[model samples]
Target chain A: MAEGKFTQETVSMTDAQKKAQRSRNIIIALVLAAFVVLLYFGTQAKLGANILQRPL
Target chain B: MSVEAIETKSDDVLISSAMPGDYYRLMKPRVMYLVIFTAFVGMLLAPANINPLLGFIAILCISIGAGASGSLNMWYDADIDAVMDRTAKRPVPTGAVTPDQALSFGIILSVFSVITLGLMVNWLSAFLLAFTIFFYAVIYTMWLKRSTPQNIVIGGAAGAFPPMIGWAAMTGSVTIESIVLFAIIFLWTPPHFWALALFRLKDYENASVPMLPNVAGERSTRNQILGYAVLLALSGILPAVLGFASIYYGVFSAALGARFLWLSFKVWKNGSENEHYGFEKKLFGFSIFYLFAIFAALGTEAVIMRVIG
Candidate 1:
């Protein structure tokens, strides 16, 4: 269908758009890092010194 | 058909202009955040011992599933979304993402999230996650949204399922605790959405979305909101009553419940078709906080108890 054909066109990103994309990637990376940090602390709190124990 | 012919034939040319940012927007990141938080609370409140890495993976899958549902909803609702001022600028409507692209993106993500969750975590939660997507995309977005005034009332079950899914991710089965969490969200959504509908009645009217205020009249909507708020307040206290949360949580949630009810009453008494004050908006905003704070209290207490006990 022409509708599907319409969606296949490639887009050229502008410099500003590239910058915005980079910023979004950075924010996503930061959020992932925060999640890892929270997970580490939570595991530590829950497991105490046994945090590194293997899965049962 | 020539490319030139295609370009000149329609004013609304469906171009593929979607950047990564537009893809992110397609996920409805704000709603995704709320889903993540509530699901995280479900993870915390469960009695099973989940490994840290697996828990993280489960939460990630849940987030992706939520995102998938949002994208699918946007894809299906693009018609009305283009017409309604509130949603006119959404990625699909604005042509940042074509409908086909959005639909493909959603389907792929939904399948990926479900399979990944099932393989990495447990199958029960994955099943719940898949059902949530189907319910939201098909039942709510495709059917209930345009057909019924009680759309959000029944469709709220989709949102309320995340916590239960998270709980299942941990325990591999649902429990009373998770059901209580589900009930709280399910009860809260009617008032939360109806209040927003009160303020944005024109938008719904224009979209022909059958939101409560547009269908039931403001008085009936407000009365229903008050009624739901009462049930929400009671549901908010069940964790403490069932012996999972602390008395402090009981007291805090009860107070929040009372405030929520009072605001609902204010909205009911003062809500008008012509006069647009901040009362309904205030209730809408507080409704967000009320959910977040209630879940936060529950999760924090559970975490502290895990550390201390």
Candidate 2:
């Protein structure tokens, strides 16, 4: 009978890859912020100026 | 004694190596620019006035929708894109973004743009935007492109819908004027694309994509290009003919159309036998300018009329 040896491999992202990932994260954050702003203004425009004047 | 070793899974090492710019490239910015310009013109030419904020929202939605279609196109066509010189460097083809990532991005943007448009603006425009995305992503990219010579001819409708969608965004309905704008783009597509196909016949052949010049032969494609050019030239003046634009615009369009016809004729007569297909290349370049010039003239005329009256 022969005994087998097991080996484990470890991997890490390069600096370039890390920078790219960080840039993508920043862009995603900016886009989400922009989308929120768009929604706020869109709601205001859709509701119009008399939005707050509704009867309780 | 026993020792334990820790290993990182391959997929877990780097979630994604794609840059933000790579994702932007996947969206085909040039094509999105054209869609945005045409849709903006449509909004301006519309009979009813749109609120400025709403109009900006509409254009943003339409542009994002166009970009989403482009991303989906790159995802589905990545294989052929890798073979074609023109598309070889696209994000998916170059491996900057994986196909699954591109697909997810496209689907997410498509849903977001459509839902936002419906919620912020009107449902009709939203529906048109959704349909346009489907037509481009599924009909044009997934089906027609791999199958037939008439791919662009029919697929052109997907591109033509932006202006109609814009008009609907403003007016909440489709009208003859919008249809005329659609027809202008529809008629212009075959010649514009066929001219490119003539120059890049080998690329289509290598990719097994049946472009007109590849399947129909150069002579037939050239003639068809000339035919479409003639139709496009006539359609270019339709807005003026229909009283939507000034007679001065009609004259300007006529001059541009004549140049288009002359270039098409040159391509037809000379054939693609030339080394560079110079005539075809010239016509292709001119066709882009012709569409832009015609749309710019119409949009400018509308603005002037609104200002004066």
Candidate 3:
């Protein structure tokens, strides 16, 4: 068997850059969560109680 | 000596330093506010009752679509934005966000907003939203803005579509009442923007934007402002004339329209020779209040009528 070789690169980020990246990530996560909530509620409102009557 | 140092020495890695706030600013929150307000008014004035959740979704989609267009506009206009005092500090112009990032952000939001609206709401509203983004981004920002003095006049249609979209979201079709709402904004846009252009003549000239004041000269621009102002005043009272709004709203609209015309007259007569352009500034300020007041009056009347009935 041949041995596998791997290389990893690390880039340094400034404090400000890291903070900004963190803020962006948090916002993206929140937006995605909000979208999921909206989708669930929107489906409920749109389909009403009939949503539960679907056949398997 | 570490991996970071080795990577730094081998090649410079460019990481975006853009904060979330910078991304928000790229969306033109102020303009989005106006779009949301007008769209809300349209939804209220719509004859059909809307599901509250659906209505909220519709407004959100419309606002996101508008913001997407604003992002695209900022992306494409970054060069000119850098030259203009008013827009020099925008995210793209100030290096807080790159143009390519802004473009991708806009395209992604535009597609997302449109698709979500279509799937969640009605397709008609989604289509209108899609067209509005296309009009603002492609027609106005990319083409007409650099090419003609009539850019705002034609581009105004994109801004005017929100109320119609809102109405369509509720009713699933366009109607004369919604068209009247659209016409008010359409007519109101020229005078409002021209008032700003009159005061910012030098900025427009510096940017080589061919604003009416820059190309047709201030005199023509002032005359055109007055002309549009007159049309706007009549259009403001159209809801009453057409019997959609109550007499009280009509009287209120009339009074507001009179003030609009009076200010516009001052702007027209004062000419561009005034050192301060005070009348132009006043007109510009009042125009914002005028549109807001008109839409608010209509919305209030709608709510009152619904309550009374």
Candidate 4:
């Protein structure tokens, strides 16, 4: 993460980077699950053409 | 991806060595995650379902617009970003991406995303997309950020627009439901960022960015953090009380929200700012989870409602 001194978020080899990375991974997993869960809604019978219809 | 890589490499060098990471960095992926997640919730809660393909397209456009905003922000803030520890190594300031290139790239993608949404969803969503870009890059970054201490507090409306944008993409109209989502995030921003500002206080001071820590004493900032935290905590309960959410959503939101308040409480009472342990910093870290967890819960509730109700 360290880009050097001239930039923001000094990519210092600190413990913080490792932690932030782990947190980021967990977030990615959750978002993926949300995406899968959302997919279930798309397949519901009530969805129908309403899925394609623009709100008028 | 390759093109983005080339854009970051100086035109001064004949053959560019642009990496996908450069584009990722330029997109400000972290902010984009929150933007996309909130927008996803809005789409889920819409009165109608969007076709999965179109839904995907709508999300793509929103994400692209969000990326465009990041690029524009990076383009404009290269100077201040150079000074701040958090943003110094960004593609633009790091000489990885050229400013003019970023500007044009952002504008083009902004247009593309807005147009795509308009064509696939509705003009309302399209218009909102256009507005979000202008608000984030122009209003928040250009006008408010450096000029005021209340920057994130007020400028936060830009970030708050996501769920509304998502709702528009699906329903092509706005409603109290969407607006309430907007208000929740709107109110949530002050405390979220203020907590961040508390720990990164020195960064703002060094950048002369006029964040709350620079303008308000740590005491006043701490008080404000607590105040906003309480507001966020209360707002979390609204989905249930308004009869819009199930007991599950209510209980879960409240629980996560209370933890949020607890963290803010720590920052309020213990963020004396003179100590080295930096508990306020820890609160700031967890606060990201606080927001993400609640929003994720909202998304989960929507899915459950769809499946069972």
Candidate number of the best TM-score: 3
How far does residue B164 in candidate 1 sit from its true spot (Å)?
A: 0.5
Error of 3 at A47 (Å): 1.2
Residue-level error in angstroms, candidate 3, position B43? 0.3
lDDT of 1 by residue, B10-90 (tens): 445433435677888899999899899999999998998887878887898899999999999999999999988889999
Could you give the interface RMSD of each candidate, to one decimal? 8.7, 10.7, 11.2, 11.7
Q: Count the backbone clashes (under 3 Å) in each candidate.
A: 0, 0, 0, 15
Runs in model 1 lying further than 4 Å from the true structure? A1-56, B1-15
Instruction: Return model 2's CA RMSD, one decimal.
Output: 4.8
For every candidate, C-alpha RMSD to the true structure in Å: 6.1, 4.8, 5.0, 10.0
DockQ of each: 0.10, 0.28, 0.27, 0.04
* Tens digits of lDDT, candidate 2, B137-190: 999999999998999999999999999999999999999999999999999999
Per-residue lDDT for A1-56 in model 3, tens only? 01112235645566777788899999999999999999999989888899899798
Return the DockQ of model 4.
Answer: 0.04
List candidate 2 segments past 4 Å from native: A1-11, A53-56, B1-14
Pick by TM-score: 3 or 4, better one:
3
The stretch of ten residues in a row with the least summed lDDT in candidate 1 chain B is B9-18
Task: Score every model by TM-score.
Answer: 0.83, 0.93, 0.94, 0.79
Compare candidates 2 and 3 on lDDT and give the better one.
3
- For model 2, chain A alone compared with the true chain A gives a TM-score of 0.66
- Candidate 3 recovers a fraction of native contacts equal to 0.45
TM-score of chain B of each: 0.95, 0.96, 0.96, 0.91
Model 3, which residues run further than 4 Å from truth? Answer: A1-8, A53-56, B1-12
Error of 3 at B293 (Å): 0.4
